[model samples]
Target: MSGNIASLRKEFFQLKKDLLSSILSVGISLILFPFLLGMENSLKGPIFSYIEAFIMYAIFSLPYLILIGVPVHIVSRVATKNMKTYKWVTSFFLHVIPALLIGYFLFKNTLFFLGSTVVISVIFFSVGYLLNSIGASKRQKLIIALLPFILWLLILIPTILTETTNKALMNEPNPEVEVLVNETSFKPRPSFCWNSDGSAGCFEDKEPFLLPIDPIGEEIQTNGDVTVKVLLHNTERSYTIEAYYFDEENSIQKVTGDPHSFTLPQHIQEQAVKVIATMDSSKKGSFFIPIRTGNR
Candidate 1:
């Protein structure tokens, strides 16, 4: 009876260890996923912003990780335990397929969703396997646990430096140019939607919502060509400028560069001119500047 009790306690401790390992693996993979996605877009932000976003995404995805990721991870670990020769093959089926199915429900693009799941599953399995490897030292396990964060910093630091350098070069004074408005803001929107048919869909808006321009006066008076700069943060896409007065289209200008400038019409008194930054046909952002004719 004592022997059976000792064996049961041993089994219980081993189970606890496995569960903790699975949670760590899944949590690391979840945290790394957004950074991986950001890499496709050149990780276009500061390191701190990326960290902040990671924290926010982790917070929001915690429940999903607990509900789906932990169970799947444990199941894969258990299913592949006895299959030493075919462990990887078994792990792939057990880990990747279920994750792919979940991704299919959550994402619309077949290739993108499949690719993301495969990457995540690979990370999850690799981390778990490294942690549970026979004869692995505690130091080795610690390294495995921290590998994701190390990899993230390795990639993130250089990207940020390059971006900073480019911005510095762009900021160098040119005698022929003048920057009227330079502002930045954080505005993020949902990238996915759900259809009535229980399928994932792309979230596209016919007209994107307007983001307020701070420190730039909404009312202004200009006697000649009034140059105004506009920028949309955290996007690599180009935006076109459209000017409207009295609810009629005045002029449309396609802007292909960041920190672009546009000239507002002169001699317009107390009438608001709407300047829109249209990124794509599906989305746009705008701000209003009330034009006054008289001088200060």
Candidate 2:
């Protein structure tokens, strides 16, 4: 009876050890997955803040590790399992295939994801093997496994600096497609555009002039008379607008119209004009609109 009890206790301890090791491997792999993989383009967006990105990354990786990654990790850890025979078979079916498909939707490069998973798997399982096989104190084992993460952090610092330096170097804008519209303090550059009536916005050369900030309404461009109505709606929401027409000598004439119902005077006809405006609404933004005369 004493002998049987000893055997049972020893078996229970071994099982517990294996379970804890497996859990640690899974947890560490999921956490490291995103960081090791360079996924800036896929993760980046105006809508995604840092907290949201971290939460999303965790949510995305959790289920996958639970379903496939954990299983393979445990099976590979089993003493009876020959890693040489199972490496490709398990990795291809359980890790690579699913990861590639998921990456197709989540990332720009599918192969990149596969490579990341491969690296993660190698690091993860390799650490687990070291932890289990090596006879050392628990503290010593933790330090051993943590070496890889420490190395990764060291590499990450220089990569970030390089990316920042590259972005700073690319300070110039596309001169062929975009032009600056600044002139002076009292008088600025004039603009001319049309209503989005079938042709969308009226063009200067070919492509329609686009406002950097979006409009309150669906249509960006409005005509001489139509813009007056737009100003009325925008002003009610605490928007300030300045409308003026420019003569051939670049002298600008301010179009002082009522915020409720503005109308362009007949005298200010047959020339290009613009309105610079800013709004303080739910979607607080600013833009410039140009109205072409004699056309629309």
Q: Highest TM-score: which candidate?
A: 1
lDDT of 2 by residue, 45-121 (tens): 52454435456767877776677666666655554335655443453344335544555555655445555555555
Give candidate 1's TM-score: 0.43
lDDT minimum window of 10 residues, candidate 1? 181-190
In candidate 2, the residue pairs with backbone N, CA or C atoms under 3 Å apart (3 or more residues apart, or in different chains) clash, namely 193-290, 196-200
**Candidate that scores best on lDDT:** 1
Model 2: how far is 223 from its true place, Å? 36
Shift of residue 93 alpha carbon in model 2, Å = 14
Distance from true location, Cα of 84 in model 1, Å: 4.6
- At residue 121, what lDDT does model 1 achieve? 63
Displacement of the residue 281 alpha carbon in candidate 1, Å: 17
TM-score, every prediction? 0.43, 0.39
